[model samples]
Target: MLHYAYGAVKKSMEAYVTRTGSNLLEVPLPFAVKSNDEIVSEFRKALERGKSNGNRVRLNVIDHVTSMPCVVIPVKELIQICREEWVDHVFVDAAHSIGCTDVDMKEIGADFYTSNLHKWFFYPPSIAS
Candidate 1:
C-alpha cells in the first residue's frame, strides 16, 4: 500500500492492515512540497522504491486536498501514475474538497472516493458522500 503522510484516512487504513497482517509503506510529504508537481513527485518516487525492492504496490490511498497542511493534490495525475506503476486499486480521500473544488469523479477516475459533506457543504457532521 502507498499512503500519504498525515492522510486523513491513515488511522482506518492502519486498523485494516493490522487485521490483515499487511505491510504498509507511507509516502512522505514534507513541508517543502507546496506545489502539485512536488506532491506527485513524492508518490512517484515511493512507487519506484517499492518496485526496486520487488514489492508491487497493490493499493494507494491518496488525498484530493490535505486537511492539516491544506495542499491541493493533483488527484488525476497521481491516479495516472498509479496506473502506469500497475497499482491494483486507489482510494481517494476528498474530505476537504467536495464543495471547495471542482471534483468530477469520472474525470478523476479512482477505484474509490470519499468526502464529508459537512466539511464544505454545510451538512450535518455525520453526513458524507
Candidate 2:
C-alpha cells in the first residue's frame, strides 16, 4: 500500500548522524487542486438525494461490519470535511488506535497518520506497557 506522512511528522525526527539521508518529507499539496467540480457536484447531489435525514459518516470501520472499534468518532471524517472544503493535509495521530483496531492505512483515506506500535498494538519496545 502507498504511504504519506504529515509535515510535522516528517520534521519531528532528529537530524541524522551518519552519511545516510532522511527519506521523510512533508508531502506537498497537489500543485493543481480540483474542487467545485464533478466530484463535488456528485457528492452534493448524492447528499441531496436523501430527504429528512440525520446521517453520520464513520471512516474507521472494522470491515464495515457490526461494530465500532472505539467510542470516539472516526478521525477520517475530518479528512472528508477538509477535503470537501478544499483544504490541504490531514494529520492522523494513531497513538490510541493502532493494533487495537484495524488501521487500514490505505482505506482510511487520510493524507497522513502517525502510529506508534506500542500504544495500541503492544508492539515496539519504545512504547510503554
Candidate 3:
C-alpha cells in the first residue's frame, strides 16, 4: 500500500487553483511542500477569494506534520484550525509516511491521505497480487 497515498489530497488543491487564480502557500520555497501549514494557507486563500468557509469545499482535508523526513506539523493544531476555519475538504499528503512512519488511517483522522509505499515502505516494483 502507498504510504501517504497518491497525490489524492492535492486533488482538492487543484480544484482551488482551478476555481480561483490565487497562490497562498505557507512554504512556497525551493520545493513545493505538502505540509499542514501549506494546506491551511490554500484554504485560507480560497476563502479570501469569495469562497464560502462553511460550504466552500464539499470535502474535508488537512496537512500533517511528518517526522519521517525532517518534516513536522502539529496534526492536532491543523485539525483545530480546520474546525475553526470550517473547511469542506480534508486531504493529507503523506507520501513519506508509509514505512518510515506508522500511519493509521483512522488515527490520522483525515478525510483523505496521499501516500506512496515505494518511497518509504519498500514496495516491490510493479509487483501485484
The model with the greatest lDDT is 1
Q: Whose TM-score is greatest here? A: 1
Question: Which model is ahead, 1 or 3, in terms of TM-score?
Answer: 1
- C-alpha local distance difference test of each model: 0.80, 0.39, 0.49
TM-score computed on alpha carbons, candidate 2? 0.39
- TM-score on alpha carbons, each prediction: 0.87, 0.39, 0.49
Score candidate 1 by lDDT: 0.80
lDDT of 3 by residue, 1-129 (tens): 112223444565567767886432332211245665664564455444434343343444343534333454445455455556665556666655566556667766666776655665467754311
The runs of at least 3 residues in candidate 3 whose Cα sits more than 4 Å from the true structure, single-residue gaps closed, are: 1-16, 19-69, 124-129
Give the per-residue lDDT digits (tens) of candidate 1, residues 1-129: 334435437877788889988767788777757677777788888888867758787789888877776777888999999999899999888887888789899999999998998877788999888
Better of 1 and 2 by lDDT: 1
Residue pairs clashing, model 1: none
What is the descending TM-score order? 1, 3, 2
Q: Which should have the higher TM-score, number 2 or number 3?
A: 3
**For residues 1-129, could you state the per-residue lDDT of candidate 2 as single tens digits?**
001222333334324312344232221222232432433344334333321254322221111111222232244544575466444455566655655567676777776666566655567768632
**Poorest 10 consecutive residues of model 3 by lDDT?**
23-32
